[model samples]
Target: MEERNRSASLRRALTVLDHVRAHPGLTLTQLAEAVGLSKSTVLRLTAPLIEAGLLDRDRDSGLYRLGHGALRLGQAYLDTLDLRAVAAEESHRLMAEVGETVHLVVPDHPHVVYIDKVENEASVRMASRIGSRGPVHCTAVGKAILAWQPAELLTGLVLEPRTRHTITDVERLRAELAQIRRRGYAVDDRENEPEVRCVAAPIFDHQDAVAAAVSVSGLTSRITAARVRELGPLVAAAAARISSKLGSTTR
Candidate 1:
């Protein structure tokens, strides 16, 4: 009986997640009605999910939406599959060819998170950890992903001022994103770290959306302005090849 009850609860949780995925901005009342449960029961079930960060509640509107934790979990599940693993090999190759640290980053919440990385044997080491979060406005991988983001997603981002080098001006950031799109790559010239530089390009999915970014990073001395320019196209080409392997046809 206990096992059956647990199974039923799991099914109900899945149903709630599916419903939220279909209708992102759902009120508690609406969710309760749709799930065929009382308001109190629905709230109780959703409490753990909210605590786990799988769902979020809008304070002003009193609506529940899918949260960053859910997206991170979904991305992690995808990474464990064949696609991200295959991309990792390409990232490793790029690191080897460029003699720099190559990172694979994905958008999460208001920041970008490094999912995988490969470091060149001869390159100056970076301070980045596998699960480290980076600012979107000042990082090559972040700019690469932002350049290909939908307008709606761009609007939803909140640009906080973290450092003097951070791009806080909205119009200027947009212009920079535009340049990134046109150039097919992005360069972070010590924007995030004072003595580090990086060049990055977008990785697309089958749907041609910017699913991730690949970047090659090194110290400022090794990756000078001219070297950044030279490596930009190389990173972009590598990213494009990986995107093609993932069945992306659109630029």
Candidate 2:
């Protein structure tokens, strides 16, 4: 009975906080009505939240609002989130839907580092490993992320040739990046590896900056140009989901 009462009190306190967060500057009476509690009970509930710095009450206006404690808690959650773990579900789903290997990579300035890979039993195994690095100029995942980055970053990039299809010309690569931004995805038609093809999309962070990219990779025999067009939107949608999970408001 004692424990049950404590749990109820905790729930009530949290409810009060939620109400204030949704309707900031709410008066004591308004908050009570919102949470379906009496004025006195709401006041008692808010006492703890106010003391803990999760809420603030305006002395002159008797209005309630969220406090710095809420910001700190939100920041703590964002800081603890791991990019690989956040993108894991979408990466696996993309691989399952496409029947190809999926890779998750993060920007490493002039390159992208593979941080995770997902594939099924019959999926074509990619040469990429979790810790391996690929040039930003030649890999689909790399180009996907670079497309959203600051334009100045492109000026300093060295467009080295990886294969005959690789875009070694800076002007052409710039045009390719523009196309990627317009289409919401990027494609590597045997540019990184002569026999491999890939389609990738950028992942955004809370600030709407490109934080990473997700890609579907397979042999040229399986992932042809037509197939890339089909997989482009699928990969982009998967990356958008991952970005949403990371607190991105805009995809």
lDDT of 1 by residue, 1-251 (tens): 99999889888887887788778898999999998988898887788888888998899998989988898887785566565686877887888788999998888846899988888767577889998999887889998998877756667567766546678777888999999999999988777887888899999986788888899999989999999989999999989988887767865
| True lDDT of residue 225, candidate 2 | 87
How well does model 2 score by local distance difference test? Answer: 0.91
Instruction: Return the TM-score for each candidate structure.
Output: 0.65, 0.79
Model 2 agreement with the true structure over 1-251: per-residue lDDT tens digits: 99999999999999889888879998998889888999999989989888888999999999999999988987998998999999988888888898999999999989899999997778666778899999998999999998998889988788888899999988999999999999999999999899999999999997888999999999999998899999999999999999999988766
Per-candidate count of clashing residue pairs (backbone under 3 Å): 0, 0
Off by over 4 Å in 2: 1-52, 57-65
Clashing pairs for predicted structure model 1, backbone only: none
- Cα shift from native, residue 205, model 1 (Å): 0.4
Q: Score candidate 1 by lDDT.
A: 0.85
Collision pairs in model 2: none
